[model samples]
Target: MKWQNSLKDYQLYLKIERGLSKNSIDNYILDVKKLIDYLDANHINISPVSISSEIVQQFIYEVAKTVNSRSQSRIISGLRSFFNYLIFEDYRADNPLELIESPKIGRKLPDTLAEEEIDQIISAVDLSKPEGERNRAMLETLYGCGLRVSELINLKLSDLFFEEGFIKVTGKGDKQRFVPIVDATKNYINIYRYQIRIHTNIQSGHEDTLFLNRRGKQLTRAMVFTIIKQLVEKIGLKKKISPHTFRHSFATHLLQNNADLRSIQLMLGHESITTTEIYVHLDRQHLKGVVEKFHPRK
Candidate 1:
C-alpha cells in the first residue's frame, strides 16, 4: 500500500481503536511522514509494507543527527507503533522496528516551584485589569486541581460541583474524573464568574466554557502558556516555567507533605501508579521521613 493510504488507516486506528487525542495522533502521523520524506529525499521508492529494516535504520540514523535523544526516542516509538498497526491489520507479517531499541535516557524530573514561589507567581497578577480575577482563578484551578493544560482549557461550567466539593475533569483519552476542589479555589472561580465573566458578551457555543478570552470565546492552550510566562517575567523569577509547572508543584508539594502515591495518582488522573511515583523521587526528604517513621530497623 501507499504510505499515505497506510497512514490514513493508522490515524483512524489510533483515534477510534486506541482513543488517542488529536495531538497524539498528529505526532504519530508526523513520525511516519518524516520517514516518507526521508525516502523521497534519498530517491528511494518504497511502500510501507515493502520498506525494509535497513531503510528504516537509515532514516533513524539521519534523525539522530537532528534531534536530541529524548525526541529521537519518541520518534522511534511512534514509528514502531505505526508498523505494529500494519502488522495487526495483516498488511505486514511483522513490525520492522521490532528489533530496534530506544536509547537509554535518564528519567527527567519535572521542575517544581516551592510553595512560596507559587504564592509569588500568583500574587504577581495585576488585579487592576478586568482579566486579573479570571487569570487568578485559572492559575488557582491549574495548581489546585493538578490539571493538564488541555483539561484546564476544556473545563466547562457544568463540570464544577462546588457543593460536592469536586470538579469533573475530562483528562487524556476523554476519561473523566472527579477532583476535589478546595474552598479557596472555589471562591476565586466564583469571584471571576459572578463579577467578571457575567459582564463579558460570551459567544455562542462557548457559553458553558469556564474560561474565555477577551473575545468571549474559549481560551487556547497557548494563551494559558502566555499568561503564565508573563506572570513569571513580572515576578522577576529566573526559573523557566509553564502551566505544567504548577501541576508538578501541586503533585510535588502533596508528596512532600506525606500524601500517598495512589491518592496523588488518582488526583493527577494518572493511568498508572508508576507515573505518580516520579514525585517520590522529587522529594527525597519525604522518603527519608517515611523510612524514619516506619522502618523496623530505624
Candidate 2:
C-alpha cells in the first residue's frame, strides 16, 4: 500500500480503536513520515510492505546523529508500534524493526519543586489583571489534582463536583477517574469560575471548558507551558520546569508526607502502579525515617 494510505489507516485505528489523543497520533505518524521522507530523499521507491529492516535501520542511524537518546528511543518505539499495527492488519507478515533494538536510556527522574517554591510560583501571579485569578486557579488545580497539562486544558465546568469533593478527569485513552479536590483548590476554581470565567464571552464549542484564553477558546498545551515559563522567569527561579513540574511536586510532596503509592496512582489516573512508583523520589531523611520506623530488625 502507499505510505499515505497506510498512515491514514493507522491514524484511524489509533483514534477509533486505541483511543489515543490527536497529539499522540500525530507523533506516531510523524515517526513513520520521517522514514518515508528518508526513502524519498535517497531516491528509493518502496512500499510499506516491501521496506526492509536494513533500510529502516539506515534511517534510524541517520536520526541518531540529530536527536538525543531519549528522543531516538521514542522514535523507535513509535515505528515499532506502527509496524505491529500493520502485522495485525495482515498488511505485513512481520515487523521490519523487530530485529532492531531501541537504544538504552537511563530512567530520568522528574524535577519537583519544594512547597515554598511552589507557593512562590503561584504568588508571582499579578492579581491586577483579570487573567491573574484565572492563572492562579489554573496553577492550583494543576498541582492540587496532579493533572497532566492536557487534562488541565480539557477540564470542564461540568467536571467539577465540589459538594462531593471530587472532580471527574478524562485521562489518556479517554479513561475517566474521580480525583478528590481539596477545599482550597475548589475555592480557587470557584473564584475563577464565578468571578472571571463568567465575564468572558464564551466560545460556542468551548462553553463547558473550564479554562479559556482571553479569546474565550480553550487554552492550548503550548499556552500552558508559556504561562509557567513566564512565571519562572519572573520569580527568578533556576529550575527547568514545565506544567508537569507542578504535578511532580504534587506527588513528591504527598509521598514525602507519607501518602501511599496506590492512592497516588489512582489520583494520577496511571494505568500501572509502576508508573506511579516513579514519584518515589524520597530523600535520605525520609528514607532513614522509614527504615527506622518499619524495619523488622529495628
Candidate 3:
C-alpha cells in the first residue's frame, strides 16, 4: 500500500474512532509526515508497510538533533501510535517501535501567575477601546473558570447558566462539563454580551459564539494568544505568559486556598487526578500548611 493511503486511513481512525481533536490529529500526522519527508529527501522509496526499525531509528536520530528531549519523546510516541494503528489494521505483523524506548525526562511543571500578577495583566486592558470589555471578559473567563483557550473561544451564549451559577464547557475530545461560575465572572461576561456584543453585526453562523473578532466572526486560537501577549507586554511583565497561564494560576490558587484536587480536576475537565497533581507541586507551602494543620503529631 502507498504511504499516503495508510496515512489517510490513520487520520480517519484518529478522528472517527479515537475522537481526537483536529489539533491532536494534525500533531499525530505530523510525526508520520516527518518520516515521509526524510525518506523522500534521501531518495529512499519504501512504503510504511515495508519500512524497518533501522530506518525509523535513523529518522528519530535526525529528529533528536533539532528538538529537545521532551519533544523527541513526543515524536517517538506519536510514531509508535501510528505504527500500532497499522498493526491493528493487519497491515503489519509487528510494531517497528516496539523495542524503542523513550528518553528519561523530568515532568516539566506548568508556569503560573500570582493573584497580583493576574490582576496587573487584566488591569492593563484598555477599557477605552471597544474590544476592551471583550478582552477583559475573556481573560476573566479563562482564569475564573480555568478553561482551555479552545473552550473559551468556543463558548456559546446558550451555555451560560447564570441562575444556576454554572457554564457548560466543551473540553478535549468534545467532552462536556459544567463548571461553577462566580458572580464576578458572570457580571463581566454579561457586560460584554449585553453591551458590546449586541452592537456587533454578528455573522450568520457565529451568532451563538460568545466572543467575536472585529468582523463579528468567532475568535481564533491565535487571536486569544495575541490578546494575552499584548496584555503581558502592556503590564511590562517579563513572564512568558499565554492564555493557559491563567488556567494554571486558577488551579494553583485554588489548591493553595485548600480546595480539593478532585474538585479542581473536575472543574478543569482533566481526565485523571494525576494531571491535576501538578498544582500540588506548585504550592509546597500549602502542603506544609496542610501537614501542620491536620497531621496527628502537629
The sequence of per-residue lDDT tens digits that candidate 1 reaches over residues 178-197 is: 99999999999999999999
Provide the lDDT at 129 for model 1: 98
Lowest lDDT sum, 10 consecutive residues, model 1, at: 278-287
Error at 156, model 1, angstroms: 0.0
lDDT of 3 by residue, 80-140 (tens): 9999999999999988888888988998789999999999999999999989999999999
Poorest lDDT segment (10 consecutive residues) of candidate 3:
280-289
Best of the two (1, 2) by TM-score: 1
Each candidate structure's TM-score, on Cα atoms with residue i matched to residue i, is 0.97, 0.96, 0.97
Candidate 2, position 198, lDDT: 95
| lDDT tens digits by residue: candidate 2, 22-74 | 88889999999999899999999999998999999999999999999999999
Count of steric clashes across candidates, in order: 0, 0, 0
Each prediction's Cα RMSD? 1.1, 1.2, 1.1
